[model samples]
Each structure stands twice: as structure tokens, then as C-alpha cells.
Target: MLSGLDPSGGAGIQADIQAITSLGCHPLPVLTCLTVQDTRNVYGASPVDAELIRQQLECVADDSTIHAIKTGALGNAGIVDVVVEFIRKRPDVPVITDPVIKAAGGGDLADDALITAMKERLFPLAEMITPNGEELVILGGDADADRAAQNLMDRGCGSVLATGGHGTGVHIVNRLYNHAPDPMQWEIERIGGEYHGTGCTLAAAIAAGRATGLSARAAIAQAQNYVHRAILHALAVGKGQPVPDRGIQWER
Candidate 1:
């Protein structure tokens, strides 16, 4: 269920659909929010009609195997409640939550209450939350990636894959943290840009991997690899943002 993005065909549900299809999975989108901006950043956002959101879900739920589910940019508290409740009912499916609180080009997508809702409710329902740096700070209450991940786990996430793409460093550090046990891994790379649709691409790739029968860990790894490759072949499609060449189906 992709949310908090517009149908600009550049990011959000548009990007999610492309990423999912690139991996040969049909994207069944339940848009949770809508935006009024483009590639550069979001200028304004509106949550999708709650009842309409449910109707869309019902339209596809009974007819699909729905191997995995992914969520992005739910900008408000009420909508978060609806999404959390939706996922809660589907416990067996792997839920990939991309906590998008801000845009890559710079903008606020959620307020304190919405952020708090994510921490207290949505975090627990998530199998794994792929949060950007700033979102992590709000959810974890600490800038330290390790500490923030633990805080997310304490809120009930089975795993918190804290993405460090926004953090300052020569290499990007994407860490998968299992709070219950002591296991973690990081991916470092210096070759990436401020690409558009990055979060949607990653989360949808994970969902696509899961739909194709990958376990949580395997799905995460494969999805990360896929997204990395997509970034490597990103295209400057817009004046403000570059879209990943996800259309090119590359192999690793």
C-alpha cells in the first residue's frame, strides 16, 4: 500500500508501481496520501480518503496472493491508524514500511503527532521499517543509528533497517538491526546521488523480493542490491529530480 505520494509518475505510487513491475510483480497500490508537487520536493500533501483507501484494498485483497505489502509516506495520525490497522490484520504478510517524513529535496511531510503515532503504533506493526536519517531521529529520539534502531525495536519492530543515505559521510551506511538478538550488517557506497523515488524503489523492491518467495533477510538484501543498481543507472528525467532507470531490469 503506497502512500503519502502523488501520481506524478516520478515518485511515490508511481515509482512504487514501476519498481514492483520491474521485478515482475503486479503492484496493487492503496494510496494513503497525495502530494501536490513534483521531482524536487513536496510543496503540499493530502491524505487519501480513508474510506476510499479501504475500498481499494478490498478490491484487490481477495483476488491476489499478495505475497508482500509495502507502505510509504503516511503523513497524518488518522491515516497512520488506518494503515496500521490494515497491516495488523495481515500478520502473515511481510510488511515493509518506508517511513518518509521528509522529501529528498527538502520538505516536511508529517508533524510531531504523526511522527509520534508512527513510533507508538506503526513501528510495532512493521516487520521492518526503512527510515531515512531524519525520520530515524524522530522515531528513535537519538541521532546515533545504533541507538535509534534499538529504540525502534523497543517499539516492537522485528527489525529496523536504518538507512544512512542522508547522513554525513563518504559512504552510505545501510544497517539491518535485529533488536532481540545481536546481529547487524552495513552497506557502504560512495556512488549515489540525490535521486528521486529512492525510498519508494527500495521498499517496493523489498516487497517484490518477498512476493517472489524471499525471506525477510534475503528480501532485504536482494532489494537493497536491486535499488543500488537502479541508482547506478539513474536518469536525469526532470529539471529538479533524477529518476532511477528502473525500467532497465538489470541483473546482479
Candidate 2:
């Protein structure tokens, strides 16, 4: 995993590791950004140096059994470029990128340069990029949902799953589009609550599914279904923000 830090462990790499582990995959993570943040909002974030990133990737890449990868909250363009080049060497691994643009609690995660870097470097390297409604807008400024997804395809990802969590509707809708397969839409009722790291958890869950032998489409479906439950039993970990229990079903 590549992501910003979450001091509260309610989001970012902390959440990704938990979600991946809960889904029965061994979680190996690489942190791209260190952040001063609680569940409510981010105070500040700085991406790590590119050399540090390359060193981490080199170390982790030594492990031969890692079959899948997930990325979230890269702090800048430089980090994205380094990661893109690294992944190019392992085109066989399934990569699920959670293109997180803003904090669920309303803090901005990427500036213009970083956003451009994400589009140019990271999106193309990913097998599937997951962006929520707000992120889609940021990823494809002025493009609507369908257009944004298409733009991502044009930019080179094999697939884009543009989640509609912020749109105005009683039912939360998640849509997935592939360059080859027909598009599919999945909807669930909007459970009333504030949750952080939902996107990261979802992406990691998908990666975990892939590691466990599911095809890309089946992996995504399992992830979507798992997210519904994780949010339903979300635990309030901070005064103002909630973290979904990746083990939501463990003791139920």
C-alpha cells in the first residue's frame, strides 16, 4: 500500500492494512506520505522523498509471493512517478488504486501538481483505479461521471470504478467500467453516518480478494459487498470521525 498517514489509525495505510488482513491476505505496505491527521481532518501532510520511496519499493519487491498491490493517498507527483516506474516492472500483479482526492472529513489531500501527477503516472500503471464522485471530478475536471471514467480509460487504465458516494441519492451507487467488458452498477442504501477510510478499505479489500484467487470482476464484487457491512458497524474512534471495523463480521 502507498498512502498518507493517519495518526488515528482510522484511515490511510493503517486502515488498508487492517482491511487487507481482515480479508485474509498478508498485508505488505509502503508508505508514501506521512500526515498529521485525526479522523476528523488532516492538519498537514508531506510526502516522503523519492529516494526513500525507491528504497522501500526495492525492499518490498524482494518478496516474490506478493501477488497484488493497492495504493492510496500519494502525497505528490514525484512519489507517483517513482511508483509508476516501479510497477511497470511487474505488470502481472493486480493493482487496485484508490485515487483519494479529499479526506472523507473534508480535508484536501492533493494539490494541482499532485493531481496532474496522479493522472499522468499512477492511473496508467494501475489495473483498476477507484475514485469516488469527488475524486472523479478532481481527476477529470469538468467531466461528468461517465466522461471521467472514460477519460481514465483513455489515459490508460484497463478499468475505472467511479464510486458515486457523494452524489445526491437515497441509494449509494457504485459503478465500474472496463475498456472491454460492459459496465456494471451496484447500489446500496445510504447508511446515515460519517466514515473515514472507506475508500482505502474498499480498495484493499479488492486487492485481498484478488490475492485469494478471485478474478478482477469477482474481487470487486466481494469488496463492494464487504464495504456495506464494514460501514454498517463502523466504530467511532475519534471525537469527530469514525473508523469502519474491518473485522465487522468476525464476532458478529
Candidate 3:
């Protein structure tokens, strides 16, 4: 997994670890950046050196049989380039990319150059790219969801999972576009109260599911269900937005 380090443990690589572990996969996290923030907001971020990230990737690859890759909050174009190159060599690995452009409480995590790098290089290698509605608009440069998803597909992304958590509605509608005649969608009832790390958890869960041999569609469904449950049991750890209970026990 490639992501930033969150000191608060509400999101970033911390969330990825929780979600992946909850789903029975051991997480091999490589920090792309270090964030200065709490549960309320992100004050700033410092990206890790590209060479250091490369070394970490190399070390992990040498020791483990990686089953899947999950990425979140890559801080800059240089880090994106490093990650893209590493992923390029592992063509068979299923990659679930959470395009975290902005923090949950409103702070830019990635700049324009990094976004461009992701679109031009990283996104194409992904098995699935999970973007919230606003991110879809920015990445695809289109207001129309379908058009935006199509735009991303044209850029070589294998599939796009456009999350609706940022959209205003009675139900959160998550749509998956994979070049089929019709997209697969799930209408989840909106759970009230803002929650941190939902995106990271969702993407990580999907990657874990994929690692366990679930198909893309099945993994998405499983992840959606997992996130919904996590949100329902969200933890009120700080002043702003609650954190998803990624480690919450399932109701038997």
C-alpha cells in the first residue's frame, strides 16, 4: 500500500492498515508523505523523497509475494512517478487506487502536477480507481458523471468507481464503469454525520477482497458493505468528523 502517514490515525495509511487487516490481509505500507494534522483538518504535508520511496518499495517487493496494491494520498508528482514505475513492473497485481486529492476536512493533499501525473501515468495501471464525486469532476474535467467516467476510461483506467459520499442526496449512489453497456451501481442510504477515512477504508477493503480472489464487481460490493458498516459504528475521536470504525466487529 502507498499512502501518507496520518498522526491522528483517523485516515491515510493508518486507515489502510485497519481495513486491510480487518479483511485478513497483511498490509505492506509504504509512506508517500507525512501529514501534519488531526482528526479535524490537515495543516500541511511533506512528501517523502522519491528515492526513499523507491527503496522502500524495493525492500517490500523483495520480501513478500504481493497480492494486491492500494494507493492513497500520494503527495506529489515525483512520488507518483516512483509509484507508477514500481506498479508498472507488477502488471498482474490488482491495484485499487483511491484518488485522494483533498483531505476529508478540506485541504489539498495533491497539487495539480500530481493530479496530472496520476492521470497521465498512474491511473492507467490501476485495476480500479475510486474517486468521490468532486474528484471525478476534477480528474475527468466534466460535470456529467457518465461523461467524466468515460473520460477517465479513455485515459486507460481499467474501471472507475465514482463514490457519491460527497454528493448531496438521500442515498449515496456509487457507480462503477467498466465499459459495459450499463454501469453497476449501489444505492446506499446516507448515514448521517461526517466520517474520516471512509475513502481509504473502502479502497483498502476492495484491494483486500481482490487479494483473496474476489472479482472486481464482487470486491466492490463487499467493500461497500464493509464501509457502510464501519460508518454506522463510526468513532467520535475528535471535534470534526468522526472516524470510521474499520476495526469494528461484525454483527453475527
Candidate 4:
């Protein structure tokens, strides 16, 4: 796992760890940046030294037999470059990237340079990218969801999972675009109220499913189900948004 640190434990690496562990996969967490944030919003962020991130990744790689990689808020272009280089060396591992451009509370987490780096370098290396509707539009550079997904695929991304949390609707729709001509989609009943760490939890759960040998389609389906259940059992941790009850038991 490569991501930022959220002290509130509502998102970022903390959320990744919880989701991965719950799904029975051991996480090898590598911090890319640190954020001063809570359930309400992100106040500020600072990227960890790129060299330090590289060293952490190298050390973890040398020590563990990595099954999957999941990345979240990489603070800058330099951090993205480091992650890209690390992923290049381990081509066999499936990578699930959550293109975190803005926080759930509407705070900007990434700028143009970092976004460009991810589009050019990191997206090509990922097995799949989990982006909400807004992120899909920004990254794909098109307003239409289908066109945006295609633009990403054209840029060498293996697949796109456009989530519907940010969209206006009665049901949350998540679509997966892959080798098939038509995309696979799931319409989950939209749970009322906002929840923090949903994107991280869903992406990490997918990584865990892939690590445990589930197919991409299966992994996506199961992960979405898992997140829905989690939100249904959410915890009122702070004044802003509820945190998913990731500890809710589920049969593996």
C-alpha cells in the first residue's frame, strides 16, 4: 500500500490497512505524504521526501512477497515518479490506484503537475483505477463518462472503474470498463449521508481480492458489496462525515 497518512484514521493509509487486513491480506504500507485533516476537510498536506519513499518501498519489497499494490494520495509529481518506478520493477503485481484529486469534503489534494504525472506514467502501470465521477472527468479530460473512460484506456490504462458516489441519483452506479465491448456496472442503493474513506476502502478491498486470486470483475463486485455494507454500518466518528464500519464481519 502506497498512500498518505490521515491522523483521524478515516482515510488514507489507515483506511487501507483496515480494509486489506479485514479481507485477509497483509498490507505493506509505504507512506507517500502526510495530511493535516479530519472528517470535515483537509487543511494542508506535505509530501514525504521522494528518496525516503523509495527507500521504504524498496525495503518492503525486499522483505515481503507482494501480492498487490494500492495507491491513494500521492502528494506530488516526485512521489508519483517514485511509485511508478517501483511498480515498473514488479510488473506482475496488480495495482489498484484511487485517483484522489479532491477530498470527500471538497478540498483539493492534487494539483496539475501531479495529475499529469499520474496520467502519463502511473495510470499505464495500474491494473485498474478507481475514480469517482469528478475524478474521471478531470483525469480523462472529458465530461462524458464513457468518453472519459475511453480516453484513459487510450492512454494505456488497463481498466477504469468509474464510481458513482459523487453523482446525483437514488442509486450509486459503479462501472467497470475492460476488454469487453460493454462495461460492467452495478447499481447499489444509495445510502444517505456522506461517508469518509469510502474510495480508499473500496480500492483496498479490490486489491485484497486480487491478491487472493479473484478475477478483476469478481473483485470489483465483491469490493463494492463490501463497501456498501460498511457504509450501512457506519460509525459517527466526527462532526463532518461518518466513517465506514470496516470492522463489520463478513465471511471470506
List per-prediction Cα lDDT, in the order shown. 0.79, 0.83, 0.92, 0.93
Sorted on TM-score, best first, the list reads: 4, 3, 2, 1
Query: Model 2: residues >4 Å from true position, as ranges?
Result: 180-182, 250-252
In model 2, state the lDDT of residue 132. 86
Candidate 3 stretches with Cα past 4 Å from truth are: 250-252
Q: Highest TM-score: which candidate?
A: 4
Residue-level lDDT of model 1, residues 21-125, one tens digit each, is: 888889888777778877787888887777777767766887776788888887688877777777878888888888888888777888888888888888887
Task: Give lDDT tens digits, candidate 2, residues 46-71.
Answer: 88898899888888788656789898
User: Could you arrange the candidates by lDDT from highest to lowest?
Assistant: 4, 3, 2, 1
Candidate 4 to native Cα RMSD, angstroms? 0.9
lDDT by residue for model 3 over 1-252, one digit each (tens)?
Answer: 999998989999999999988888899999999999888889999999999999999999999999999999998999998998999899999999999998877888988899999999999999999999889999999999999999999999999999988777789999999999889989998998668888898999999999999999888888889899999988888888899999977432
Question: Model 1 residue 172 lDDT?
Answer: 74
Measured over all alpha carbons after superposition, the RMSD of each candidate to the real structure, in angstroms, is 1.9, 2.0, 1.2, 0.9
Task: Encode model 4's per-residue lDDT on 129-218: one tens digit a residue.
Answer: 999999999999999999999999999999999999767779999999885799998999999867999999999999999999999988
| 10 residues in a row with least lDDT, candidate 3 | 243-252
Q: How high is the lDDT of residue 9 in model 1? A: 60
TM-score-superior candidate, 1 or 3:
3
Query: What clash pairs does model 4 have?
Result: none
TM-score of each: 0.92, 0.93, 0.97, 0.98
Q: Model 2: how large is the Cα RMSD against the reference?
A: 2.0
